[model samples]
Target: MSLIYPPLQAPKRLLFGPGPSMVAPRVYQAMTQNVVGHLDPFFFQVADEIRSLLGYAYSTSNQFNLAISGTGSSGMEAAVANFTEPGMKFALLTNGFFGDRLGEMARRQGGEVVRLAKPWGEPYDPQEGREFILRERPQVVAFVQAETSTGMFNQAKPICEAAHEVDALTIADCVTSLGGMPVLVDENGIDIAYSCTQKGLGCPPGLAPMTVSPRALDRLKARKTPVQSWYLDLQLLDTFYTGHKYHHTASATLFYALREGLAMVAEEGRENRWQRHQRNHQAFVAGIEAMGLGMHVQNPAGRLWTLNTPRVPEGVDDAKVRAWLLEKRGIEIAGGFGPLAGKVFRIGLMGHGSTEDNVALILEALADALKA
Candidate 1:
């Protein structure tokens, strides 16, 4: 007996959701290149180039920078697991979902979690974060530089400074900001920073590009207990990346895609790419305001260039609007989470997806959806 399956035909969508943004044609082409064994010499050369490019992307000189063989969440887990131990004090600055997730990961690692929370869609004041860090005296301080859940961008420099004052390591989640904005891991004093390839890098979601400062690496080296996650252990990963040891099988295809994406970033110039995102974001905001819609993030400084959360109009059906956009226009925008549910639309303009054309199209489609 023979079984028949339908041919895979995925819809061509203008992804304006929180993540997995549109990939560049170059990245797709890179993925189609011939695969190599994870431990092959040729693969090692690819890995070396990726590490170098990742450092450029992260704006860091740290030799520990490399792409973890998992999604953004894996990078989160790795950062937490390596730096935390039982009964350690971990201070998390939270205002949205991803911040809360860092707290959860810390707790799972037996960290005595201390959370300093601000209202959703708001950025934490640097002074307040400093006070919290001093008061909590945590061994590790974690926060999201770009809060994807709320479309807010937090000030990282002051937070890192405060953490350092307390002799604490700072972990920054740059998943949404790395390629789109200036993460400046070294300048901001971030000890460990992790990001995803899909959102800002214009690649498929698979690799998590991460960097660890010397201070963070020293802390990891001095850990009393073994890292909880065997696969995500940084020491083991470091050995693998440094010594060409076989710790695990990493896909060469994904590495190819990541390299190609990073190459694009380098070619465009990081600052120029950031300005492009900012320009597109400003255009989107202007269009939304013209349509009589308000933004969810009130503070101009708090707003993220890549992710935009426009308030759902009063008496308008949020789900219906999202559905109509998807069904009629083939555009995919997301709804809010937790306290923000049904109150706002989470639209992303990231990487190759961030364009003047997309901004205009989405605005027009959104206007039509609202009217219908």
Candidate 2:
């Protein structure tokens, strides 16, 4: 017997999860536009627009900026693999899952990885980080600027200064921070940074927004060995993004979506967008606390405005509450992972999805779900 494949129709959902926050309507509409060849002049214009917007969103003046055709992990691996070589020492500040993953990726690339581990939900202190750096004297120091898993924000300035003082390259994971907060990569002295389009960019997940400072680019230029991951090698990828011809099959449709998304971001204005997210986050916290729920991250200033993790009330099964929210209310909130598993629920207020109404709706549903 032959079976027929069905057409697609996605259910309407209010996404308040760790990633894949709701795509702006404009971005969604752009995805449905006419598809063009990747090499077309118009497509190159789209690429140019995307690079400019990414630089603005990331608050960077770096000449090297591109969106890789993959998720945030792809960007992370690309940054580490291209710049770090075998037998080189690298220090990783691990307080959450993504930080550990970066460390693992660095090790896999044959870099000697040393950890300056901190408790989850706590940002690493710059002085302590410096002490570790001085002890390890690593060639590179990496940390997550926004620890999504634990709802902690690592202030990039001090950490970058400490790394730079010791002559180590600074790599930051802004996967959950970009477009939500001021990254100010050039001002903060970040050598390399990577973000995901799905989180704060109000776009779907396929693209990894990445940028490298002139210093990091210099390292790539001076590398004695080829990058282990040929597909992610920045030297060749630069050729495709620059004057040289295409090196791989680029996604024209997604590029269109990204261009439209960046346009919406420009319309909203970056500073205004950041303030909007902060406002919604404050309101969400107020509503949740008013309902007697506690926040996981102690310092309000250190909490990630885009991704909020609230402590799950006692006797409330996170799985059950999450299921009720999705199946019954059509609202999606994420459960904790790694060290935070079953302890807190991650609620994202990001990009176009960060709104007063959305926050209140999620809180109301959450209160009811908790009572049930």
Candidate 3:
């Protein structure tokens, strides 16, 4: 006889981790809508609307805005693979794990990588970045706007200006910032910006929303060598999204989820949503400090409102605390990694999860766990 297993049933989790934050009920409902063909006219209409909403979310007027049919990492790869050519110089600003990953992607694309290193849990100096860009004169400069690993928020305007000064394209990893904070791609002069459907968008994973400025498109058009990744090639992908051409079998359900999530963002208004994240972050910080815990990001201005990294108490085991919270309270919080492993806990308050009730609940649970 075949072994029997229960039907798929997932518990209700209060997601307080770095990503895949709590999805809104409406978004879940939308995902259950009837599936449609990738090339169906109605699905194409959904794709078009997503492009416009993504433009609003990113605060950009770039014409190349579209959602890649993968996670945020796919967006990262697309940004690097399309812009980087063999022997082309690429300057990467490394202040955390994601920045280092960008540098690695650039290197794999055959670009000569020049990493501008900064300590984790710190932000980069604009002047230093400008000077580095001028000295290196790399063809592309990339940085993470929100460093989720250490909860550091990087300033984009200075970095973009610096890259533009030397005619280098700017690529911003807005994975943890978009929808939760002000990306303002046009105002910041970012040539390319990429984010995911999860996190601040309050949607499921599998969609990477991205936009590319005209300057970056011009450079891509002028490139002598073809882009390496066929699946992520912008030239081919554009035809499918922009024109009535077929590229791949895009998931209609994921698009439905993203569209509903974007609708929620629009309903709340961007500024209001950002302020909500900020307020919750402040409250969380106050609670953490009151419990005698410290934050990983020392500089107030460098702190990411979406992802807060609180230092693990000296005597407590980080894993034990996280496990206890999950088992006893059904709360899902993540521990830090890389240099911050066993040193800090990453608690995210983003999108629908960025609420007063959730903040209070997490803080109470954390305090109890610490005391235990």
**TM-scores of the models, in the given order?**
0.98, 0.98, 0.98
**lDDT for each of the candidates?**
0.92, 0.88, 0.92
RMSD in Å for all candidates = 0.9, 1.1, 1.0
**CA shift at 48, candidate 2, in angstroms?**
0.9
lDDT of 1 by residue, 76-146 (tens): 99999999999999999999999999999998999999999988888777888899999999999999999
Candidate 2 displacement at residue 87 in angstroms: 0.8
Deviation (Å) of 251 in candidate 2: 0.3
Candidate 3 accuracy as lDDT: 0.92
Error of 2 at 21 (Å): 0.4
Model 2 global lDDT (CA atoms, 0 to 1): 0.88
Ten residues in a row with the worst lDDT in model 3? Answer: 121-130
Checking candidate 3 for backbone clashes, the offending pairs are none
RMSD of 1: 0.9
Query: In candidate 2, what are the lDDT values of residues 151-266, reduced to their tens digit?
Result: 88888888788888788999999999988887889888889999988888889989888999988888888898989987898888878778747878788888887787777878
Q: Tell me the spans in candidate 2 whose CA falls farther than 4 Å from its real position.
A: none
Model 2, TM vs. native? 0.98
